[model samples]
Structures are given as structure tokens and as C-alpha cells.
Target: MEKKFNKVVLAYSGGLDTSIIIAWLKETYGCEVIAVSANVGQADELEGLEAKALATGASKYIELDLRKEFVEDFIFPAIKANAKYEGKYLLGTSLARPIIGKKLVEVAKAEGADAICHGCTGKGNDQVRFELAIKAFAPDMPIIAPWRVWDIKSRDDEIDYAEARKIPLKINRETNYSKDKNLWHLSHEGLDLENPANEPKYDEILELGVSPEKAPDTPTYVTITFEKGIPVALDGEKMDGVTLIEKLNKIGGANGIGIIDMVENRLVGMKSRGVYETPGGTILYQAHQDLEEITVDKYTAHFKQKVSLELADILYNGYWYSPLTEAINAFVDKTQENVNGDVKLKLYKGNIIEAGMTSPTSLYSEQTASFGEDDDYNQADSAGFINLYGLPIKMIAKAKEGSL
Candidate 1:
């Protein structure tokens, strides 16, 4: 049974799955297909995409450049909270999805399309991510996910189909590992990465991050300036969020700043091993954490640690458009109002050393905290303070003994 959708806006990447999906949607549903490629620092990934979409029988092709928007909006906001999934994995691929999905909905509404579609596999988090955003933006709009509906199961079959139609794709049988790249990071999975013990080979298949052994020997210094929790400059030069990040990627990548190979429990089910490259993000996260040590207070600082874990799940499982995410972001924004400062870091091999940190709103008081002849902190206050602090333990010990 073919459901009636007059026009469909497909979240097309011109990749293996989406390339086949464009042709499949045209053949199966008999609907007009409008391909929308989101440029979230993947402009290089869009090489000859327009011609390919046209050859695949798409009615039109649109390439939306969302690099600046992605950094200023999604990437910066997540970094503001210092949100890291599972303590090591930065939510790189995770954060980019909702922004793309949001833009897809906007394009769909503008085009007056009857339905929206994506090439996400049912097993992955992206299917949930894309669908949730679509539902949030247009609850009534129908979504056509080809991977779930199609009879073909593997990338091999998809490759064969593309070959049958003479569709030129960047990936092949040996080279293709499922990947998602954005401004913040690049993710690698769906191949030998399935095995927990298997070490990833440094091949062209994985190019986004540098290997630790291959990194530079010399230490690189980076001074990142921040204004109210947002990174504003690199070294001594003022730069925009996107440009600064790009510069950091080069510096950090050379020094092997961010690379993670972990067996993470997926949001859907089952544990999966994933390799990620988060060059700029690693530096930023380290800098943010360094700044937070001085800028954020003890209570909000500790609480934000717990909130960071929650924010990780919220981002990883793709609830960016939901109310919970909105509330969490609001809370994060409030706490970060005082997170203004600069962090100096020394990058050597795989280690990020915090050189120094300075913030206008810093709570570190020399008068109260310094050991060098501080007048404000009287020695007498500590005598009663220690008794009060330890009273509960003291009472418990005395009651247990017969001295209460």
C-alpha cells in the first residue's frame, strides 16, 4: 500500500544510503523528491552532490550552509554546559543531528512538502533523533524512513544498487565505515569497530583525528579567551566561534588532543564500540572545566557535574527539541552567566595541561583562601567550625560507646 504524499523533502547527504534512498523513494512512492543536504562542516562531503541528486531523479537539490549556525547555536550551548557523554565522549555527532533536523523541517515547511524523510537506519540513534525533531516541528507531517521500510539490509546491497544505476559514491565496499561528521567531531563505527578488542587502523578510512604516536613532539600553547561562557578568541587573535574551532582542530589534531575508542551502551539497545575525533571539542572542554574551577561556585559547580551527566543523555539520545532539554539548557545558561574568562593550555602529545586561568567573575579570593598572612580568615573561627562540622560523627561514636 502506497501512502499518498505529493511532495517529499528528503534529508539527503548524497552518501551511499541516501543516494539509493532518493532513487528508491522516487520508484516506490511515486512522489516528487526534493533533496536537502545540510552543510554542518561537511561541505567537503558534498562534492558533486547536486549532479548526483539530479541524476538520481530528484526534482531539486538544496545545500544549506549551516556551519556558523551550528557552532554559534548547538555546539557553543552544549560546550557552555561542558556536556560530555560517558565522561570521555563529547556529544559531537549527537549535537549536529537536531540542528540538521530542525533545518530540514524548516525547508520542508517552506517547500510545502507533504512529507519528510531520512536515510537513518532503525538501529541507530539518528532515526530517533531525526524523527523527534520532525515531530516537534510538524507533529502532523508524515516521515518516510527508507532503511526501516526497505528490503535491503546491508551496505553491500546498497552499494550494488548504486552500482546498478551507475551512481558515483565516495564510499566503496572496503573503504566504507559508517561515519557522521560535523564541526565539533567525526564519528567512526559499523565496521571492525564492532569488536571491542579490535584496534582501529590509521588509514584513509579514518582521517579526522591524529594517532598518538604520530602526533607532534613539541608542546603547543593555546590561550582561549571567553566572554560569559562563550569562547571568543584563540591565542591573541579575535575569532568567531566557527573559525576559532577550525583553528583549534588543526592545533589539537597535530598534538593528538581528542580521540576516543569505547564500547558505549546505545540509547536503543546493546553495546557498540565507537571511535570519535573531537579535536577542538577536547581543547574547549578542558578549557571550560579549567575556568569552571574558579568561576562557578562550590554548590552550582558540584551540581553542574550531575547536570552534565544528565545533559549527556539528553544530547546523546536526541531530545534536543524536547521540554527536558529546554529546561536543562536554561539551567545551564543561568549557571554559566558568571563563566567569563580565559584559559591557557599546553598541548603535548595526548595530554592537555592547564597552564593558567583567569575570569572576571571568579570566586577565588586571596583574602579568604590564601595561606600567605590572610587577615579575613581568623584562626578562632575554625575551632567552633570543626566541632560543628564533626558533631554528627562525634554523637554517633559517643552513643555507641556508653559516654553519650
Candidate 2:
């Protein structure tokens, strides 16, 4: 017995899984399959995707150019929140999912489709990210996740099925690394990365840039300008969010600015090893932090650190549109109001060194912190302040001395 629907809009990537998914959707459910690809700066990945979808039996294929929107909408907000999963991973793949899922919902509604489909597997966090976004946008829309329902068990099994159906694929058995690329980052999982003991073969697997060992000996200098915590310019050239990120990717990659390998706790209660390349993103994060140090007050900066942890967890767990995320973003936006500044960074063989930072809203005062200041201070005033501040320690020391 075949389950039937009028139409289903699939969040397609033209990758191995989705290429096979389009045919499976048509054969298993007898529904019209519409493939939608959102271009979020995945340079070569979008090539021939439309024709590929159609050849794979999709009734229609729609590719949306979402690079600018992805950066200004999703990327900037995460930057403002300073969101990082487990303190190293930049949440690159995690951040892209919501925008892609949101676009799928829009396409499904416009096409008058009753269902939305994805190629995410049962064990992965992406399934939660995609389905949650779908449920958020269109609660009644049916979600047809082939990995969860179908009998296909592994990538080898999927490859065999694709071969049997005569579907063309970019991936084969030897290409072991599963990758996801967007403007912000490129992520690699599977293959040797499945084992924690196995070191990532960076020389072979890296797509965006060379490893630090292979980077040039000469250091590179770059200046980044931010307004309200969003990066607006790089190296004194003003550009849009997408352009700035793209330019930095090239500059940072040349100098080996960002590369991370970590074993992270997945949302599904399992550990997964992933290698992420975030060349431009790493520079931006370092620059933003430097600017914030001068512009943000101590208390607010401390409090925002706590908020950043919550924001990172929400993003990694795929709650981008939830009320809690909205609230935290609202708070983050308020903090960025004063975070306007320019930061100069020295990129050298995978190290982001803070060269300098300046802000009109900077809370630092040379006169107040100077050692030889003559005005507005009494040298004896520190004695009273120290006594009050250390009263508890002083009392504890006296009690111990008396007992001895």
C-alpha cells in the first residue's frame, strides 16, 4: 500500500541523500515532489542543482538565492549573541538549518503543497532543527522524513539504491567525509572523524583553506568595523554583510585563521566528532569580542556571557524561532547598541591576535586609570576601600590566629 499526497515540497541539497529522496518520495507516496534549494553561499554546491533535481524525477525545482538574507538575518544575530556551541564550534551548520527550513515552509505554502520533506536521519540533530522550524511555521503541514520511515539503513545502502535507480551522484563509497557548506562555514563529519582517537587528516579533508602548517610565514593585518555589533566593513572598505564575510573568508583562510576539531554532545544524547572550518567567522568573533571589551560595561558583559551560553544551546538544539530565542535576541540587541567600534586583528598561522580596538562609547578612561593622576583622587582613600572589601577575609584570619 502506498501513501498518497497531492504534492510535497522537499528541502533538497542535490547531495547523495536528497537526490535519492526525490525519487523515493515519488515512488513511495505517489506525490508530486518539488525540490527547493536555498543558496547560503555554498559556492560550487549550487551548480547544476536544478537540472539534477528535475532529472531525478522532481516535478519542479526552485533555487532561492538567500546569501544576503542568511547573513543579515541569521548570522548577524548569532554574532550579536556571541553564540558558540561548547565554546569552540561556531554553530555554522546549526545556524543554517533554521533559515533553510523557513524557506521550505514558504515554498510549501506558495505551491499549495500539503507536506514538506527532508533527508535528515533519525539520529541526527538536523531532523529536530528542520521539523521544529516546519512545525513553527506551518503546524498542520505533514513532514515526510524518509530516513525515519524508510528501510534504508546506511550511506552504502543509499548508494546501492541510487545505483539501482540509475541516479547520478557526486559521492561514492571512497568519499567518506559527509560535508555541509555554506557562506559562514564548512563542516565535515563521518569517515575517520567517527572515531575520537583518530586525528583529523586536515591536509586531505580541508576544503576552505590550508592547514596552519601549510599557511604562509608572513602575517596578515585586517581591520574590521562594527556598528551595533554587526560587522559593516573590512580593511577600511565598506561592504554589505555577505560581501564582508566573503572577503574575510579569503583573507582569513590565506592566514589559516579558523579551524576546529571537537567531540561535541549531540542534542540526541550522543557524542559526535566534527571538524569545522570557519575562517571568516573566527576573525569576526575575535574582533567583536575585542570591541565589546572596550564598549560594554563590566556587569553587562558578565551577564551577557551567561546569556550567550543559553543562546548557543538554543541554536544548537534548533529553537531559532522559539519565544525564548526571540527574548534572548532582544536582550542581545540592546547590549549591542553601544558596541560600535573598529578592531584591528593580526592573523598569523591560525592565531587571531588582537592588534588594537577603539570605540566612541568606550568606558575606559586614561585619567582615571593613570598611576600619576593628580586630580579627583586621594592616595589614602584606597585603605578604607580595601578594609571594607576584605572584611570577611580579615575576620576569618583573626579567628584562626586567636584559636592557634
Candidate 3:
């Protein structure tokens, strides 16, 4: 005996897993499946999705253009917090999951669907991310994770299942790397990437940019303007967040910027190796940091480093809607109040070299920092300060000498 539902709303992507999931839901539950796909800047992937979903036994297909919202509400906040998982990953997939999950709940509630479904696998962190978000919004809503319950054990098994039913797949055995793409980044996992010792064949798998060796000979310069820690312009041309990122992606990619290969610890207690391309995001982060260096004070900047690490863990673990995350964002927002400035960067051979930075609220005073005579700082005062700081050390040395 098994539970039954009259209708289910699935977080659909029109990818191989979700494509087969639509049919599986129909066959297993004998219910009307509404496929909801959120377009978080996955270009070309959403084309003809409605017709495909309907033809594959879905009762309805809903595509939501969430690009602007994703950038503003999710991505920008992560930037302000300088959120980086393990101080390496820019959290491209981590940031997109909550918004997508929020949309799934909304569609499910509107359609009066009995449950929400997703194609996230049990082994990956996405299942936790998706379900946590779903639970936050709709506490009682049942979540059907196909990868957990289904008999399919591997990607090959999924391909076989699709072939048995004549379902078309975008990837095959030869090029079956699992991927998740958004405006911020494109990630590649599985296949050769599963082995940590194997060097990634970037030329074959990279969709976002060229490798450093293949980059252009000339260095490309980009000036990013930030207001309250949010990127507002590139090369002095004012634009919205989405447009700014899009433009930088082109420039950074052409200059061979923002490619990373790492083995990250997943929330599921396992390490997974993946290669990520985040051209635009890397540039924005570097520029933002450059601005903060001049604008933010030493004490606050040091504390924010710890906050960045904590925030990264929270976001990576799918606690976006939690109270602690909200509080951390509030603090981060306050810090960004004076983070207004410009950073000029030189991109060449997979490096972001800071050419210059300027800020109206800069704490750096050249006269005070100079080695020459300065009226603001007295050299004589440091002797007294050092004596006070070294009091404990002096006492310890005296105590040992007396015994000798």
C-alpha cells in the first residue's frame, strides 16, 4: 500500500532527470502533474519547454522568469555578505535553490496540488536545500524526491529508463556530466569530475569561458562601480544588477577569469569534486572587496570575515529563510551603507589584478600611512603603547629570572 495524491507540482527544469520525472509521477501516482520551471538565467534551456512538458504527460507547464528577482533578492545579498563556501565556491547553485523552491511552493498552493516534487538526488546537497525551503513555506506539504524513492540507482539507469519510454535526452553516455547553470555560474560534476586525481578537460566541458592558456594575449581592463556594495555600473555605463553582471561575464570570460576546481565537503557527509565557472561573479566579488578595503574600517572588516564564513555555511546548508540568516543579512546590510566606491581591475590569464580603487569614504589617509613625518600619528606614543601591550610578557620573564 502507498499514499496517493490527486495532483502534484514539480520543480521542473526540462533536464533529463526532470523530463523523465514528469512521466514517472503520472505513472506512479496517476495524478495531474503541473511542471513549474523557474528561469534563473539558464538561457536556451527553457526553449520549447512547455510543449515538451505537455507532450511528456504533464497537465500544465508554467515558466516563471525569475532572473531579476534572483539577482536582486538572492545574489546581491550573498555579494554583500561576501558569502563563499569554504572560501572558494561562490555558491552559485546554493543561492538559486531557495528562490526556485519558493516558486514551487507558490505554484503548488495556487494549483491546489497535493504535493511538491523535485529531481534532486539524495546524495547531493540540493535535496536538502530544496526540501528545507519547501518546508519553511509549506510545513505540511509532502515532498516527493524521486531520486530517493525510485529504483534508478545511477545516471546510466536514468538514461536506460528514459530510453525504454522513448523520452529524449539532452545528454548521452559520452557527455553525461551533470550540470546546473544560472546567471552567476555554471557547474560541472559527475563523469571524469568524480575522480579527484583526474585533471578536468576544460576545453571539452567549459561552456562559459576559455581556459587561461587559450585566453586572449592582451589584458582587458574593467572598472566596476559599487553603491552600497551592489554593482551598479561597468566602465562608467550605468546599468541594473543583471545587466552589469551579464556585461562583466563577457569581458571576464574573454580574458580567462573565474574558473575553479575543488573538492568540497557536501552537507551529506561526503566530499565531491566539481569544476565551476563564475566569470561575472568573480569580478564583482573582487571589485567589491577592493572598495571595502578603503571604505570599511579595520575592526569591522575583520569581524565581517568571520561573518562571511558563517553566512557561507548557512547558505550552503540551505538555511536561507532561517532567523539567523536574516539577522546576519541585517548586519551585512548595515556594513554596506558606506561601501560605495569604484575598483578598476586588469584581467589576464585567469587573474584579477587590482589596478586602482577610489572611495569618498575611504579610511586610508596617505599622509598618516607614509613612512615620512606625519602630524596625525606620533612615533613617540608607540613606545608607551608597546610597553602596556607587553606587560604580561615582561612579568612572565621576570618570574622565570627570579627562579634562576
Candidate 4:
């Protein structure tokens, strides 16, 4: 038995999964489906989505241009926290999910829909991310997750369902890799990626950039400017966050930067293997970290390292709308008050080599750090410091020898 609804708002992506979901929701619950797509930098993917959604049984279709907000609110905050899930993933998919979830709720409320639906599968982290964000806004709103209820078992089954229903699909059996794309990154999962033993056919699978072996022989140098830890400029030219990332993606992709393949622990208590291509994100992260090295103090920098781990888990586990996330973000914001600087990086064949870094508020003192004789730091003071630091060791040794 299924609960009845008058209308349902769906977080539609114009993908294989969601394309079938529109028809399924109408068939199962006998409700009118209103499809909403968030344009979060999925270049050219949004084209003809409205017509496709309507043709696939959606009563109405709406596309929200969330590109600017996605960068400013979600992506920039992740950069400030240096949030990397498992210390490797730039959290491209994880970061984008919350914003999309928020938009889905907004559209549902505006359209007077009774429930919200998504294409997230039962086994994936996105199911949690999307649901949690919806819960944050609409606590009692019914979430209709089709993958948990529908009979479609696998990608092959999904393709069959679409074909039988005369639904148009962008992917075929040969190239049916499950993917999530945004301005920040492009992720590839399923197919050969499901088996941990099979090596990812990067040449065949990569969409954002070329393989490192195919990168140009000459290195490309890029200068990134940061204002309070947010990237604002490329090569010394000021630009908005969206434009900056878009430009960097082109440059970084050409140099074969930001490609990673790893097995990650999902929030759902399972391990999944995927390859992520985050060309612009990788460059921004490396450049931001380099600037922080000079601008932030040692204690704050070390503590933020721990915060980075926690923040990574929070974002990956769909706690983006929680109180803990807000508090941690406030702390991260304070740390970035002084994180203003420029970092020059040489990108060559997937390597981000630090060329130079400069910051006006840099804590680094050339005189104190220089090996040559300097009056600012007393080298002799370290002897007294060492004695006091090693006092506990001396006491332990005396006790072991029975020397009172």
C-alpha cells in the first residue's frame, strides 16, 4: 500500500534514473509530478530539459539557475574549511547535493506539492544528503525515494524501463556510467568502477580532462588570488567565483590536474569506488592551502586541520544544515580573516608544484627563519626551553633508577 498525494515535486536531473522516476511517481501514487532541475554548472545538460520533463509525464517543469549560489554558498565554504572527504575527495558531489536539496524544497512549497521525490538510489550517500536537507526545511514533508520502492534493480533495468516507456535517454548500455556533474567536478561510478579490482579506463571514462600521460610537455603556471580564503582572481585578474572556477577548469583540465581514484566509505556503511575529476577545485584547494601556510598561525592552522576532517565528514554525511556545521563554519570564517594572499602554482602533468606564495599579513619572518645569525631569535634560549620541556623525562628516568 502507498500513501496518496495530490502532487509531488521531484528533484529532476534529466538523467536516466530521474527520467523514469517521473513516470513511476505518476503511476504508483497517481499524483501530478512537477519536475524541478537545478542548474548547478552542468554545462549544456539543461538544454531541452523542460520539454523532456513535460513529455515524460511531468505536469510542469522548472529549472533554477543555481550556479552563482552553488559557488558562493556551498563550494566556497568547502574551500575555506578545506573539506575533503577521506582526505582525498574534493567533495564535489557531496557539496552540491545540499543546495540542490534546498532548491527542491523551495520549489515543492511554492508549487503546493504534497511530497518531494528524488532519484537517489537506496545504497548511495545522496539519498541521505537529499533527505536530510529536505528534513531541515520541511520536517514532516513526505519524501518519496523511488529507488527504495521501485522494481528497477540496476542500470540495465533502468535503461529497459526507459526504452519500454519510449523515454529518451542520453546514455546507452555501452556508456552507461553513473555520473554527477557540476561546475566543481565530474564523478564517474558504476560499470567498471563497481569492481575494486578493475582499473578505471581513464582515457575512455574521463570527461572533464585528459589523462596525465596525454598532458602537454610544457608546464603551465597559474596565479590564484584569495581574499579571506575565497578564490577571487586568476592570474591577478579579479573575477566572480563562477567565472574564476570555469576558467581554472579549462586550464587545469588541459594540464591533467585534479583526477583521483579511490575507494571511499559511504555514510550508508558501505565502501564504494569512484573516480572524480575536479580540475578547478584541485587547483583552488592547493593554492588556498599554500596561501594559508604563510598567513595563518601555527596553532590555528593545526587546529583547522582537525576541523577539516570533521567538516569533511559532516558534508559527506549530509549534516550541512545542522547546527554543528554552522558553528564550525563560523570558526573557519574567523581563521580566514587573515588568509589573504596569492599563490603561484606550476601545473604539469597532474602535478601542482608551488612556485611562490605571498601574503601581506604573513607570519613568516625572514630574519627569524634565516640560518644566518639574527638578533630577533636567541638560539641560546632553546637550551633552557629544552631543559624545561624534557623535565618529565628526567623525573621518569630517576624513578626507574631508584634515585630519589
Please report the candidate that would top lDDT against the real structure.
4
| Candidate 4 lDDT, 1-404, residue by residue in tens | 88999999999899999999998998899999999999999988889999999999999999899999999999999999998998899999999999999988999889899999999999999999999999999999999998998888999999999999999999999999999999999999998899999989999998888999999999999999899999989998999999999999999999999999999999889999999999999999999988999999999999999999999999999999999999999999999998988899999999999999989889999988999988788998999999999999999999999995
Sort by lDDT, best first.
Answer: 4, 3, 2, 1
- Residue 27: error of model 2 in Å? 1.2
TM-score of each: 0.97, 0.97, 0.98, 0.98
Which ranges in model 1 have alpha carbons more than 4 Å from their true place? none
* lDDT for each residue of candidate 2 in 1-404, tens digit (9 for 90 to 100): 65689899999898889989998988898889999999999989999998899998998999999998899889999898889999998999888999999999999989999999999888999999998999999988899999988999999999999999999999889885789999999999998899989988998888888899889998899999999999998878899999999889998888877999999999999999999999999999989988999899999999999999999999999999899999999999999999998999898999999898889899987777789866777889999999999999988998989952
* Local accuracy of candidate 3 as per-residue lDDT tens digits, 1-404: 55899999999998889989998998888889999999998889899899989988999999999999999999999999899999899999999999999989999999999999999999999999999999999999999999999899999999999999888888899899999999999999999899999999999998888999999888999998889999998999999988888888888887779999989999999999999999999999988988999999989999999999999999999999999999999999999999988899999999999999988878889999999988889999999999999999999998989942
Q: What is the lDDT of candidate 1?
A: 0.87
RMSD of each: 1.3, 1.4, 1.1, 1.0
Error of 3 at 203 (Å): 0.4
Q: Per-residue lDDT tens digits of candidate 1, residues 246-297?
A: 8998888888879888888788997888888888999999998899899888
Better of 1 and 4 by lDDT: 4
Residue 241, candidate 2: C-alpha displacement in angstroms: 0.5
Report every candidate's CA lDDT. 0.87, 0.91, 0.93, 0.94
